[model samples]
Target: MSATATTTVTATDSPRKGRSGARPLHLPGGISLRVERRALAVGVLLTAAALALAVVLIGTGDFPIAPWDVVQTLLGNGTPANDFIVNDLRLPRVLVALLVGAALGMAGGVFQSVSRNPLGSPDLLGFGYGSAVGALVVIILFKGGATEVAVGALAGGLLAGVAVYLLAYKQGIQGYRLVLVGIGASAILIAVIQYLITKAQMIEATRAMVWLTGSLAGRDWAQVWPLLAVCAVLFPLVLGQGRALRMMEMGDDAAHAVGVRVERTRMLLMLAAILLTTAASAAAGPISFVALAAPQLARRLTRSPGGNLLTGALMGSVLLMVSDLASQRAFGADQLPVGVVTGLVGGIYLLWLLVTERRAGRI
Candidate 1:
């Protein structure tokens, strides 16, 4: 049975009025949402920034279309050459980056919220490596096509998630235990990936290496559509669970007293997070630390508690698009994979997190 069936709200006093710039939106069945004005403004700004970066990426590639022409082409009013560059050549990769980043950001937010730990990201939790192993197996052993690789990645991620959950489950799940177990699992999976690479032929090994580096160089519409569809479906489902997730953050006993099925909700949320991670990994080859960094960055930007899914998604889109641009343009005539930039940045952030957490006596 679902928790919502028995969910009931009891108020001992009158509802407090909202603060300035916070509006109360009443919903069906007496539920209400207090929308924050500042957060909304931040989301809008981040979205515009993401769009601006997208335009820059589309216009500044090898062929170099004008920004105005990129805009006009998007609106169906540009020259055929510009249209081909913007729509056919560049836009698909940019879109893939945007969508993959958003998916990772949301997945990170979900895991972080559930674990109540800043380090509980897909990359840290072995899910990314698990997906990598699956993709590598398909690429090296089976010589599978793109769609088969995607399916393999998804299966690998889900299996990894389940393994972590079961290994961490003693009397329910503990955040630290889950993290530790996940790290161990991730180490094992990475060893497997290394062995697989060592055994592959030169051409297959090179292809696997490039994919594992997480490049957006040759992505096209085929990569974009399936990821877009997955994000479109899964994002809303996760967002809908935001309230329950927030409730769970108050601790299991407290949340249970208020009609939340803590275990079930956590399981569902973990499943959703794994699916989102799987989708992004399948599309972008486990681009590291966007998941770890984006949600934390978005929370800082919004100054809000809980997941801040909207801001996180927007921030992720901006981070990845900017990273992709830097990877391509930072070195003269030497294009780098997008993952290289994120890995370097995310490593610094992780070190900072470790020091901060240690200082706070939370690790």
Candidate 2:
């Protein structure tokens, strides 16, 4: 090749490379193409619909503010009574639901995506139980409230998740093996929860009942702070690994060939997922089904073969908001545990999933 031609090519390529580095650009629809963008749009629309449902449900309580009043109060232009009811009373509850639901949705997405199992979720795979066990230990044994409970829950969840990993590591981590181990671990943890309940004094047990069953009633800023912390840290950490995770999901050999550190990436993602789930549980005891359902729901709505983390988070927020609203208004003033409402819905969905899988011989 002529020196002049080579020099010209190098000069042209250098500016293009420099611009790519400087901008680090992403398209409006993200890295993937049209299908992903369309699915993302659908998930977002569904989430918005769910949020609207939550507003109606929340406003229909005993002191009853209309939807317009709720909007007015939200915009800082409503009557004092309406403002207090909507903002002071219901707003905090809604915030907690959104936080917890978003955390669970992302946690579920992380677990299922990292483990490569659609059935793997924090609640289903024992991470929730681990957090619950930890929080219960703190509340029951040490008489600690929010702060200690949060720490204990995070510790317990990580420990339980590690235990499941070790047990399933007999040959090496495979998706199905990890899930089966998690199921067994969850069963044992449930027994432990029952034992703790039986051993506690009645008053403590009654208070713990709220934790065990998962209720958003009387939730104040204390619970909100921990969730905020988790969201702040965990989301960034997980998001930073988005490119790495996308590669790892394609299997270890393929990922390794692409200059990825498979084991380390998996471990980090697993730990992040555990921490997110633990923090949510600590904030509000295993709120149930949202963790198990949000990712699948996101995937189905988006028609994506795998979970979309952002979409899943939105779906989760909507699920919890709607469910908590239902629990609060379905009966009366006091409100049922949000867990009960989610459990009923989640359980039915789970059963249907099993039936479909069995019929298709996918199980």
Full-model lDDT, candidate 1: 0.83
lDDT of 2 by residue, 1-363 (tens): 000010110101123434322223245554421223355356558667766865775586678878887887788999999888887787767778888998999889888877787788987789889988888888888899778877888899989989987887754478888899999999999999889989998877887787889878777777787788889988767755655566666777877897877778778878888888888887778888788889888777654444467678788888888787778777776778889999988999899988887898878
Task: Please estimate how well model 2 matches the true structure, expressed as its whole-model Cα lDDT.
Answer: 0.75
* lDDT by residue (tens digit), candidate 1, 280-348: 899889899999999898887766677777678788888899999999899878888999999988899
Question: What TM-score would every model get versus the actual structure?
Answer: 0.93, 0.85
- Listed per model in order, the count of residue pairs whose N, CA or C atoms clash below 3 Å is 0, 0
Name every residue pair that clashes in candidate 1: none
Q: Give the clashing pairs for model 2.
A: none
